[model samples]
Target: MAFGFTKIKSSPIAVDFGSDSIKVLQIVPTNPPQLIAAASVPIPDHARTDTISRMAFVSEALKNLLDTQPFKGKRAILSIPAFQTIVQHMAIPGNAQDNIEFEIGLNLQQRLNINPNRMIIRHFPCINVVKNGSTQQEIICIAAMKDIIMQYLELAAKCKLDVVGMHSEPVCMLKAFEQLQCPQDTSTAQCYIDIGSATTKVVIAHGSEMVFTKAIHAAGEQFNRQLSVKKKVAYCEARQARIAHAHGIDLEASLNNVLAQSQGGSSHVNDISAQAVIPMAKNEKTLGRREGDKDSIEQETIECLIDEVQMCLRHYHSLFPDKQVQKLIFLGGESNHTNVCQQIAQGVRIAAQLGDPFARLARIGLKNPPIGVDLDQPQPGWAVPMGLCMSEANI
Candidate 1:
């Protein structure tokens, strides 16, 4: 009952709603986290835009999850898309708790400039403050449209699931880290960057305490867009090109071929359809660039990714400039790159590393069930659901 609802007596599972898919992972804490059951299903591209349709799809998948998996739990924890919401900690003058509430109300009204009536505004006390020769408590504020939140609850209801609590994407992911018993201390800093098809989220924390969170508009699909235009290939074909590039299966010729197709020149004619082989039309696609150069396109894309990482580093440094980042985690499928972590390390002057929270789920007593769905290993895209479950279960 964390979201102003009746408290659930039993621990619920975790349900993560992603842009392209929905994942549910149930963790029953043992010595390490024990995974009771886990299931993942992709939302069709066409159905993703409709909230109602997405809900129906989620419900259908959850039913299948329950029928096929051994996870037996009724309570559920939920996570919201961090990118769609604004989350930041702002400090103001210190005052008594009641007066502070009033002051915070005014401050949010002024700073957020959003209608409180239309938005779901929740504030968590951050750190106690000393300002204007008085004691003031700082709060981390997260605001999202009420409509979006209601839609989720409504969907959950339709699915016959009871949601126990709601958590932010970063928090749930971090909870998954904790379930993993990631080396976290006051001196230890970790940054989790989830790069998806449409956007990338950067969240940094010292140990388990969150320090910074930000979102950039560039993601994996953007990379595919470039390949499509450069190779003049269909979306699926361009996607194949990108995956091949990421896996190191192809090289300059691979890219050169894509570019050749874009220019309407030569055709490889490798038993592929004319329409499928046709080079894509080019559109002005912008990305995070380390240095501005149009010709060095590959480098440009890599640098743009680094630039976003640099921004995350800057935010982390502003809070703890003296400390160094001990670990860097890439969470989304697009983050699968050989030199991406190293490149980020070079750009930010810190050791960058990839992290897998899914592996840690077992350590926290969650069961990793095989439900016949393909799980993209390497990346723990399942972190959110595991996190929500952790939040609901309190471990």
Candidate 2:
């Protein structure tokens, strides 16, 4: 009998630099991966203008987050921002395996005007294709500008952290789903809809391999803007209202101050107008229409989101005619909306549900989770960072 069995462990952190915030996660590399520390902080507006300033701002944020928690190590894997990267599908001669690198470089120059030398290009094998009456291999190519990668490295160095590996946001997202559900049949396809603050990344994958991907430039923030315009409320207030509506809560009653402010009255109501006071005192329903109006605005916003998602599905089908997306898995911040998830499922006529990465990890025995973290709840926004943590040796 082997008398010595010691549990192997590695502490690796994952930092996701998103458009709105920086999310940091430290995980102990175990079978299920234990959460050592986690923090999310907003990215200041001024820091977003340029790369140098943004890198400095991110470093500051990273220092603050790490300072607030007890993360094990300084080594980290960074999630390359989607805005700074691009994914392309290239068709090349199927038999050109001898000079595949040259073929890939030529295709990049021809299609995207991207010099392979200036960018880090990685390819994932996709299904073979028949185009122009000739057989070709379709490969998904991910490229991130060298400068962008350096920016992240610089940030890590400034934060006194070691950069171990880097991955695109979409690939990290797919990796999270792979741990969540393992498709028994390779032909069964699943689509991941990661609705973030500014963009919605739609990724179609069979098993752990990504087959198709698209980013809807308009997503959660777009809905917030529409709510602000239609509901005549401040952007912050509209964001809250949109989130409540997504949870299937009627926010009309709670939005009294916002409605009052919209009508040229102080939200605090020190000196109430006769019209405003009369409604509450006399039970007039005039202000109640605003409630109905809010509902209508929500419906319109959700419909637009559904339409965009449907178009993405159609595009995926157009390219891969034989593959059908059997399930829809929602992720990112906006996917927390139950109504949004239900509506998209109904609109697309597919089985839809939210992806809970935490719960998936828990099944593998995530130890010492943050004191109050509810593994049952679906946190769509944590997909990327969590997946990044899973990139370590044993997670």
Clashes of 2: 1
Error of 1 at 326 (Å): 3.0
Provide TM-scores for the models.
Answer: 0.74, 0.80
lDDT of 1 by residue, 192-266 (tens): 877766667777776777766766777766777776677676755566455445544344555666667767868
Clash count per candidate:
25, 1
Q: Which residues of candidate 2, in runs, are more than 4 Å off?
A: 1-5, 45-53, 244-249, 253-295, 298-308, 318-322, 361-376, 392-395
User: Which numbered prediction scores highest in TM-score against the true structure?
Assistant: 2
Kindly provide the TM-score of model 1 when superposed on the true structure, using C-alpha atoms.
0.74
So what's the TM-score on candidate 2? Answer: 0.80
Q: Can you give the lDDT of residue 139 in candidate 2?
A: 77
lDDT of 2 by residue, 195-310 (tens): 88877788888888787776777677777777778768777677656554443445564366556655787744232122101111122232112334436655675677678789
Model 1, position 356, has a per-residue lDDT of: 57
lDDT of 1 at 290: 24
How does each model score on lDDT?
0.62, 0.71
